[model samples]
Target chain A: MDVLVYIEHLNGKIADVSFELLGKGRELANALGGKLDAALIDANSDLATQLGSADHVVCAVDASFAQFSPMAYKNALAAMVKERAPRVVLIGNTSMGMDLAAGVSAATGIPLIAYANHIAVRDGAVVATAMVYGGKLFAEAEPEGEQVIISALAGSFSADAGKGEGAPIVEIFAAPTGGAGTQFKQLIQPEAADVDITKQDILVSVGRGIQNADNLEVVQELADALGGALSASRPVVDNGWLPKARQVGKSGVSVKPKLYFAVGISGAPEHIEGMKDAATIIAINSDPNAPIFEVADYGIAADLFDIVPALTERIKSG
Target chain B: MNVVVCMRQVPDLVEELEINDAGNDLNREYLKYVVNEFDEWALEQALLLKEAHGGTVTAIGLDLPEMDNALFTALAKGADAAKKIEGDFANGVSSHTAAKLFAGALQAMPYDLILTGVQSAEDLDGQVGVLLATYLGLPHVTVVTGVEVSGIQATVRKEYAGGMMSEFTVSLPAVLGIQAAKQAPRYAPVSKVRAMMKEKKIEGLSSSDGAASSGIKVRRMFKPEGGQRAEMIEGDADAIAERVVSILKERGLVK
Candidate 1:
């Protein structure tokens, strides 16, 4: 049996997620006692060797692949899948991961079991567990055949997984391409910013009800006292009251800080889904029925207008 | 300045709705729907752009009954035409899927640019614009806060953490997820509501129950428990406010 994992990267280096995928793939490969392979399609050869732990690293390299060209990347991986006929494939559930997973699944007409946090083969079929309903429910999926496709949810396993293991096995394979289907005219990169919220330990996010520009100073004071990152909801960013970089919902960054505070947010499910994994949550809102309270470890029923400044002063003094 | 605005109607998220207990299909009875809040911005931006540019504005929606109000408003705002497509909603389609669908509908009739909300009020994946570009194979600039069209390429400003903004250039046929007020959405005239209702028709088509197509299936429903109580800070309204602030500070919420 063969299980193929899709390798992902940014600028030729393996993405953090690829390691996580390897960890999950390792378990599945060991379980099936099957060879684990990876599709490493990139311009650089170094990343291919690093990801070589795969019993077979299906290498598809070309100059155009320094950055992801959807058509080229998909074509290469599809060719590998067609050739190998692997029983299952695993990918990470990130932006790139989701796109490739969907595209590949559609092309192959294979069922996609995405966002799987756990998986086990029960009596031969691949059974996967995925959290659904905004991390509110877990679905147990057992595909009927040996063939399956899955994208592992991020942060599912301990960081320890990256620490273990032998050097990746390496192999080279042919890629499918005529290059006629899709061509990237240009690749305009967003300006690089130093704020990587994923690396932050704490994120203090402000919402709309802060009452205007002056209250923002108080939020600033609080963030300084915590010596942590400060972020905002879409409204705060949209209103020109906060910078777009600070927006913390799906459009912004998906963060898992050690502590997250929701200040006056009504707790849209979209926003909550992005942050519910924070180690601790405290919600402050004037509305007694604010949805943020539903997920907060501690809730405050008071106007943010009144509380923000006071909190800032207290923290400064403390 | 030919501009295309996109909007989608979605199930109201605030409601405590459920999937039909009897099956995986939606429990439409308890569901309330809306003009997908952010999509409103996309529609508004289109109408505003058309007013500024000489070209006609056409609004396309994955036709649904509830979108009639929104489509008519788009027309009243002077959209030359409104095209509706019945699309499969259960699929976890990528913005790539949208580009595939939209590119086909738009090939014969193309625009200088297309705008969408940063994220849908429901799915909020924040990847639509990026995905669409991949499918249509156009260059895209996203997380945009401001834009200007010069020749066929666009110069756009994007905001980042710490109040930083950066500008990038994207060529035409690009998909952008517009932030609210990048350009203020014009208010629809009160008098036009009735005419819009008469003139607008929403179009819709459902794909097969492809909920599990993405391999991301919903197996069961679970709601987080929330019973821990908040102890109000003791004092008068003003004093109480002060106390709560201190609590927030104590909790590292605010300064």
Candidate 2:
């Protein structure tokens, strides 16, 4: 049986999260000894080519797929699974993925597992690591069924080396019609500067230690040198030194990057839970005993003002 | 510009959540409930919206008999009015159920916009906004950190992974799951706190006849356990690099 993976997009470009699911879906597909088909609701065929490769691409582009209508998406996905008869459907942990996964699983009367930090196949069953205890705990569950719905968290999946002998075979299928159950009467948006923070590999994150709003420029200078974006702690956002858009906490966005430099960050549980996963975490704080160092790959117990500008100048001059 | 902000009374997040009975449920012996920190921020978002656009902020939640203190917490956090669905619905009125209950409550006097935190502190499901939208039949957007409201609609900037921002605009009478979004949450003013004490306009919604059981059932809650065998890399930068390379090879996380 074929496994379906949900692909999320923004203005025609497949979201980076969709690819992450693909990266994990490939592993699960190989483990289950089945074909992997990526599902794009209201998307085009060229996305399959741009995606590099997939066993198959299911398109559900209709007037209904134009906007994210959860009811409509669930209807479309459930119908697809019935027709294709896939064993496991993979989805990202993002909004569309979370929304579609739950609804799809529930509507089809199949067990749905989500935010699967990790999943390993063994003993004729899929042991999926799902988040519990509010991102603090992980559980390995094996849903007793021929078909399973699962996902891998963002940044956990690495890009495939494409190491296997043959590349992924591409197959295209049409999305069958189901009652478009959901409707999007309107789109409400928040007011803020819209910038792409995902493309940058380097991020300079500051926490409560900055003390004042003016100190932000010190962090910004380094971010500029490295072509990275500036993010901050919850206090900074709370005080309006930076917008909530820049905040890095569990309640905010989870950032995974090649290098994240944390300045003045105390490394609280949830805040650390969000950013400590960065490939390289360089923490510079006055308190040598700050908890941020516990998870930092590189720890500098120095005044950030002295260290930040020097680092920026060094990188610039180099 | 009236808005209904949904809040949850959850275990204090700073306190370590351990399964005292050796299963999924938290031990109430050491537990004290506070408004889910993010949902507090969501109520803060509603207050800010009301302050700017001029409207009423109604706070809604399901409170146990022991949780009358939660009503004050919501009121102190700047909800103009408060409503509690009295029942034990931790599992029954799940996130989806909460959304459905709100939808049913709002069908009569739907707010111009409904605001929620991206996820509750306890459940952290992050699904209610979209689920509520599906039932309310309104447009839904999540991870919102910034908002600009016009008549009957608003524009929002949402946070994507890696701290990126995506902008979308939707008409009002819709559902929005707000993030901190840089609209600094206002602290409780002495006057506002004083006024909230006397200003009592709380309401209770009926969750009978399957309103509590309209969604999926969680069969069991499993305990989490794992330990990583660390391969520490300590030396000069060069030596550490070599050790890291070897470790990566061993773990198969790298080539």
Candidate 3:
């Protein structure tokens, strides 16, 4: 195998990021003139049926692989990498992927490039462009190794390119068991009955620049005037000013609202990943160089404190 | 339970970051350094664990600019000890090298749990904790939001995307990448930190080991290319608000 893409699945559904990797994996494999493979480690999920873009689907099915036990998955994936010795391995830059990627790299003694958004074959060597400094900058790196692992960020490639109609050769391998130090418990989903930001048409998002919890009233008033729900970045929710449901980011809800009104939010890449698809984005921040302006449809490089109230009043009077 | 918290200082993003003349790194000259935010949460988690379970919390980091102040603050916040890996790390080291260096330093220490930030701005690999665990031959979990200890096992809350969380029972002597603590990281009073600086000492560990030569090499560093940027709505707050309202109306978003 030349390119091996780890197929990440939860609750019998393959993650979109897995397909994205497979899409990019196919291209890299073609460039290397080798086969593209997918590693499916699940207890009972028939996820291999969906991995048609790959030439092979290596399945490691065991009862221990049911839930995401970090130790079990890491051991299994590491074993697969060592066995296959693929020149390039692609994993998603997600929570689960993060748990496994580095450990796999260490176990196999392969260099791991993370937060990679762009990967290409340059003179038979894999070059990757990775995000750093909260996505403020990009670093193009090339590892000097026969095999390299690259954990790609979500939405880096097109999912449609990964979806195809073909049957891949499936192979089953025994999953490593015992010496597992982690046991999975119940998954705690977000509480229901709160305003689902994903379903909202307009989302007024707040960030660290809101200053304090009491000041949330300003952004809340704006959300009310715009007939939208109040959302927040991770810091606001981390600070206990808002519920986790109201948070919008990589770990929060991905909202494609008609209008994403950002107040005092310096858009980090994770936050941008969630709301960049919003139809019309308007940002109010004092810092003109904030990354939020890059994605906003219209921006006010002024104090959000000043513009939020005036915008609320203007929308209310209208 | 004995806990070890790994901390790192990153270039403060609040200040303007300039690319170095080499075009492969940040210009450290005139750059402000601050503790990685997630690592602060990790330290807080370690402190909370120590407070609840009755153990010592040791803060460790690579020797970097202003790292002693951060260690002093940790001590003032109730850490039992502070250790720095002494070396010339002015330009910083790769996550791979740092993890190996940490593993080397930690081999002599006694710890039931090793906590570090899930990701940092400079960790291009963004897997220091995971790599560290692998190097130490320990089980690891990342993006953990909560941890509860009992006997030799720990039940932790690991967060996932879209506000989902899962509980895991991790065995002792494991590593965790703390995403957030139960509460915000507590602030240390300047006076307490000063007292710690006067009364306490940071132990130094020597390690001059370099990163693997075959590892990833940065070819260049550059700012993100600007896409279709937002149209600037100028004037006073009222005028900007009027323009916003007009855009809303134009898009049939408002009356």
Task: Give stretches of model 3 more than 4 Å off.
Answer: B208-214
B1-255: candidate 3 lDDT, tens digit per residue: 899999988888777789999999999877789999999999999999998989899999888888999999999999999999988777777888888888989989999999999888887865789999988998889999899999989999888888898889899899999998989999999999999998999999998455443287889999877669889999998889888898999998998
**Docking quality class, candidate 3:** medium
User: CA lDDT of B80 in candidate 2?
Assistant: 68
- Residues A114-191, candidate 3: write the lDDT tens digits: 889899998888999998887777899987667889988888899988988799999997668754788888799876
- Scoring each candidate complex against the real one, what DockQ results? 0.23, 0.16, 0.76
Q: Candidate 2's error at A300, in angstroms? A: 11
- For model 3, give the interface RMSD: 1.6
For candidate 1, lDDT tens digit of each residue in A1-318? 678888887645576667777767777788887988878887755775566456667778777666665556766776778778888888776545644664565556456676666777756667777644334334566554557777776666543454355566666676765443334344344435457766787777888778676688777766777677788776786667765566675446667887786787877544664677787677777766566776676677777766766665655665
* Of candidates 3 and 1, the better by lDDT: 3
Q: Give the per-residue lDDT of model 2 (tens digit) for A205-269.
A: 88878988988888888788777889887668766887656767554566787777788886654
Give the 10-residue window scoring lowest on summed lDDT in candidate 2 chain A. A159-168
Candidate number with the higher TM-score (2 or 3): 3
Query: Relative to the unseen true structure, what is the C-alpha lDDT of residue A102 in candidate 2, on a scale of 0 to 100?
Result: 51
Clashes of each: 20, 21, 0
